[model samples]
Target: MTTTVVTHQPGIIAQSQVVVQVTERDWSTSLFGCFEDIGSCLCGWLCYPCFACQVATNAGEHCITPCCVPGAMIALRLKVRARLNIQGSLCNDCLVDTFCGPCSACQMHREINNSSNGHLQ
Candidate 1:
């Protein structure tokens, strides 16, 4: 298993060590789990650009990137999957984006929100 050691300097001269285990796991929410979060679902349904921007921002990415670049959501999904060790592929990302872009964005947003306390990594 791969593990990461994170160090924190609490004081000017004192430091502490924290170990974080990196485990592979599936996504917290399915692609069709948009309705699970009413807020996310409504936001995604009513205003897709705003929802996409929120997802991108939550993932520590530029909010405007998804707007300016095509397929940016797919790239964000891939990055999040890689960071969290989620099993998926570029083809899957493409399909999700193509078929249910809004729902996919909402799902990714919820997953990221649930996984890291609203932080990306």
Candidate 2:
């Protein structure tokens, strides 16, 4: 599936904001990696288990797009997307929930907290 989003790149000076037409591929690649990478910081906001879902969808010859699932898949996808859009740029309810996994934010926070605590020892 393809989605389009408009992004503005901050310019070096005022009135220099460059509006770029971002395509899904740009985000999708990172999003896909978020699902595959065990250490992604945006995993929670995009918890689609995209890898597994792609395999299942491929086997059935279904549409190779960003489709929604239920249960674990949905839950995971939401978590991943949440992590990516943690700045309140996106909403959790707007996404389809189907999977239940450690959200990227939760994981990142845990890691950060652990690292900091370790230094206090």
Candidate 3:
């Protein structure tokens, strides 16, 4: 766990302490369980225990690094401050409604097609 204090760099003083918290995930759990959990996924904003997270959060920005699928979701759970206006591309395996993001039906169709064409692993 880590905390950070940021000031205006000038004589103006503005400081906050960020606390990192950890939670557990179950890979076998259903999709709905992950996204709809308000406490863990929607309100957890101290997942990244580094200065970069503090900087980004202070600037009101979300990280856009290419992380693994599950890892990305986990990070989202950790760094989210409030509900996002997310639009596009939910995970293909899980059928969670990612706001304005990818539709669950379309994802299911793609999966069916891939499996039928022997393209799915």
Candidate 4:
């Protein structure tokens, strides 16, 4: 006697075939690797809010949105992760934003830079 397995969801296997293959990639820069870009580090150190706003603007978000809304950085991080197919969770985003806010911002800046070919516009 043989057992047969069936999936209840239709086209589950077919959908997998239709899915586009995307290569997983890590963040272009490390969170604490701010020294790699002295300009960004100085901007983040001298005026954190300005740096955050610049990052937000570069990401197509309103300049003041990050300042007015709480957890905006986390949301931006998640967006960047999804766009790049990077593996990360909301909890991780939150933790990174909470513990190393400046570093996280710098990393996001670097990611945007790498993705956009050094154009933050």
Candidate 5:
């Protein structure tokens, strides 16, 4: 008959030394850098509703997404930042949306317009 012996370490534990590194990126443009894109600025200020719809549409959301979704601006900001690898938090998004709604919209509009991909840009 063949016998098998098993060894067990009851007092020792194995740990992994693997570390994951993530790069936090910044937005291509500043939040209030509206002058960088004339078209977006004009669209945002002259016809705010139309501008909002256009921005939402470009972001792969319904044209009226801003109108339908509660706190849509903040959520959109979070989504855009996440997609672009930009570093920020929901609280920051909310504060920016609350105080600089138009500028934020214009910035996002420019960002989406310049993004290479659909909506996620």
Candidate 6:
């Protein structure tokens, strides 16, 4: 009897295959570095709710997501961290959002602004 194997459907990796991995990265700016971006800080301090909307928009999310969707801010944080390869967990995102919400928003805004891609545009 003869048996044949198909390697196309699900794709298979050979035993000798090599995988490359890059070290996990942290956010470009510190979580508490609100002053690092003066414009974002002013926005966060002056009009918080609107600032949140802007942050959402910056993260390529709907402008109203933070207001309409519960836990949207935390979700946005996770998405941003994941998209940028930033090292973080959902629990940490939730905690940071709950405690230092304004600072977090500023950080996200700065991150998006500093990014070169058109992920937000």
| Tens-place lDDT digits, model 6, residues 1-121 | 9999985766665468779996778788998787787877988988988999988987788899998999898898888877777898889999999998888888888888777453554
- Residue-pair clashes per prediction, in order, are 0, 29, 1, 0, 0, 0
User: Which of 1 and 3 is ahead in TM-score?
Assistant: 1
lDDT of 5 at 53: 80
Model 3 per-residue lDDT at 102: 24
- Residue-by-residue lDDT tens digits, candidate 5, 1-121: 9997868677878887999877977777898788898878877888877887877887778889888888987888887877777788889889988897888899887777667554663
TM-score of candidate 3 versus the correct structure, residues matched by position = 0.18
Off by over 4 Å in 6: 1-18, 117-121
Q: What is the per-residue lDDT of model 1 for residues 12-88, given as tens digits with 9 covering 90 to 100? A: 57559999977778888888886689999999989999989999999999989899998899999898898878888
User: What's model 6's TM-score?
Assistant: 0.79
Q: How many angstroms is residue 20 displaced in model 5 relative to the true structure, after the best TM-score fit?
A: 5.7
Per-residue lDDT for 1-121 in model 2, tens only? 9997867655645465788853321122322333444544343445534533442332232323334434433443344334343222233423412132334223333432333441111
Model 5 spans > 4 angstroms off: 1-20
Where model 1 places Cα greater than 4 Å from the true spot, the runs are 1-23
Worst 10 residues of 4 by lDDT: 10-19
Candidate 1: 10-residue stretch with minimal lDDT = 6-15
Q: How accurate locally is residue 95 in candidate 4, as Cα lDDT from 0 to 100?
A: 96
Would you estimate the TM-scores of all the predictions? Answer: 0.78, 0.20, 0.18, 0.79, 0.76, 0.79
RMSD of 6: 4.1
Show the lowest summed lDDT stretch of 10 residues, model 2. Answer: 23-32
After superposing all C-alphas onto the true structure, candidate 5 shows an RMSD in angstroms of 5.5
Clashing pairs in 3: 88-101
Highest lDDT model number: 1
